[model samples]
Target: MKGRVIVLDHIAGREAAALLVDGKLTDLLVDDDSAPRPGAIFRAVCDRPIKGMGGMMLRLPDGETAFLRQGKGLALGQSMLVQVTGYADDGKAVPVTDRVLFKSRYAIVTPGKPGINISRAIRDDDVRDRLLACAHEAGVAEGFGLIIRSSAAEAADEDIIEDIAAMDALATAIMADADGAPEALTEGDGPHVLAWRDWVEPAKVVTDAGGFEDMDVLGQMVSLGQPRVGLDGPAFMYVEPTRALVAVDVNTGGDTSPASTLKANLAACRALPRALRLRGLGGQVVIDMAPMSKAHRREIEGALRSAFKTDTVDTALVGWTPLGHYELQRKRERLPLPAEVMEALA
Candidate 1:
């Protein structure tokens, strides 16, 4: 649950912002004060004969040039429209495009840049018109253009407005050389908050042992309400895995039973996904789940899905794999849950 923010100038006159809390990228704010983009149609001009390829390197009217693949009969100064597919999510670098030679739309990804060319709305409209139309469709209010982020997919219009303003302000300040302001746009709030806020009512704070000061805020919020208490167990557990066998001893305090074991198992399953997110688990992770019951199994599965819904970054539950347990693979980038979670677990 802990993270930090960094700001830098990216676009010609815009600031690029990245928020990484708990080592995971929570927000990306770009294109706050710069020109919308080179969102226009242009004709490619033969600049110079490309050394190896037959077609010359074509210069675009918008001032970008890329090599047009040889032979398919494109000539010098040909007129056509190019749309942005995907550009750098960071606002500073503009996107690049290629002439639509194929019937299907294609994205022109520039090397060393996050440029993606989206197919234009209409082949006939001017570049600016298509850009504005796309912006309008995405609900960008003014002359400002934006690359709607993944976080905004389900947000209300107001949240989107708030985010866009945060991005705009941050970007403008970056350009004006006045950047040191505390940011209001945090690493994007994932569905976790929404889930934790909406679904899992804080039953109570569970502690691994004596350390609970780190969770002071959460504890305080739920202070008025009663929370479930589990146990203050051993410092850790050692899981032994032979080439094919893994032995896990379900160690609780003095009192351990089938019901308590199931409860602890359910609790961990419910918390594990969110905990995994909080820790920012990366790449292939094999959690040797301790065994549990059939009826309890459904509840654990449901809870796992609910907790993970809030993840802002990409993750997938392939369900339980061929192994004895399920598999959770993080996209490998970004941070996972913080260590404090493991420290705080009861």
Candidate 2:
């Protein structure tokens, strides 16, 4: 409860993984078998282009369609490899990109971009040199780029080289199949595998059966369904998802001090990223912060920036709106909790 804990378990008979930090649920991954998951590579055939949208629709072998935002130079009948970028909305085609990538725990292979790069987080000169040496040792294929992930900083040399080699080989195999018909090249990793890949922090890993119940992960997941998230003393925020956007309402509750509004707003800012991560909420976000002096805007903005700095999701803080509300645009990287899972939990 005092440190990081990774729980590999099942929810509603689906694979699920939860990360708990200091006994609080900080992140979660649940398998959703309803749609093509992000990171899945497919061989697709170009359909018709949407004139005004500057994009084209692709037909997958499984009878599903995907939308590529930049479809220039693609012929109607051309076969190409595409990767699913994110889950689609109710009536929208699945968002995809022609730029496919092969990712693993320690390395990421980029096919078009041919270069050896290291994670910017690894600033130590010796570590960078060592990682570069490992990359060179792996002997990545020509015309393919390799990225040494930050997790490789502490990993053994042999492990890093092996990971790079594995990813490079996988990319080679996948690219070789580009001449074939439209079909799924590879499915994305499930919750357990993703947990091991992305949650690289040193932690206690719990993989036994009934671990979710024993560690209260199910209870925490149930809490994610509610809108209200408690912040500091007598302060809270409600994260409500609507068709258009996710609206966050911060309140000071019963506190009436002069600095109460600013305090509550800051607390809400600190708690917001984790709340959104656990709920798997993304897209447009609008925060209706408690009314405070205009002078405190900079301070609140700084708080928000610091809060999201460590969040893994791609989020852009789009400054204050004309009406004084703050807005954010986040990538739809995770699917929202499904209804059947909630029913099963209930």
Candidate 1 residue lDDT tens string, 1-346: 4434222223223223333445443333333221222223233345565557564555544454544445246544453333332223222222334422111011111212222233343243454344334334433223333543333333355544454455445433322331222211122222222222222222332223322234332232121121222223421222332233223223334445656655555555544443333333344445444555555656756766776676654556655645546555545233322233323332
Window of ten residues with lowest summed lDDT in model 1:
100-109
Give per-model TM-scores.
Answer: 0.34, 0.98
Score candidate 1 by lDDT. 0.37
lDDT of 2 by residue, 177-296 (tens): 886678999988888989988999999999999999999999888887889999899999999999989999999999999999999999999999999988889999999999998899
Q: In lDDT terms, which candidate is top?
A: 2
The clash tally of candidate 1 reads 31
- Candidate models: Cα lDDT each: 0.37, 0.92
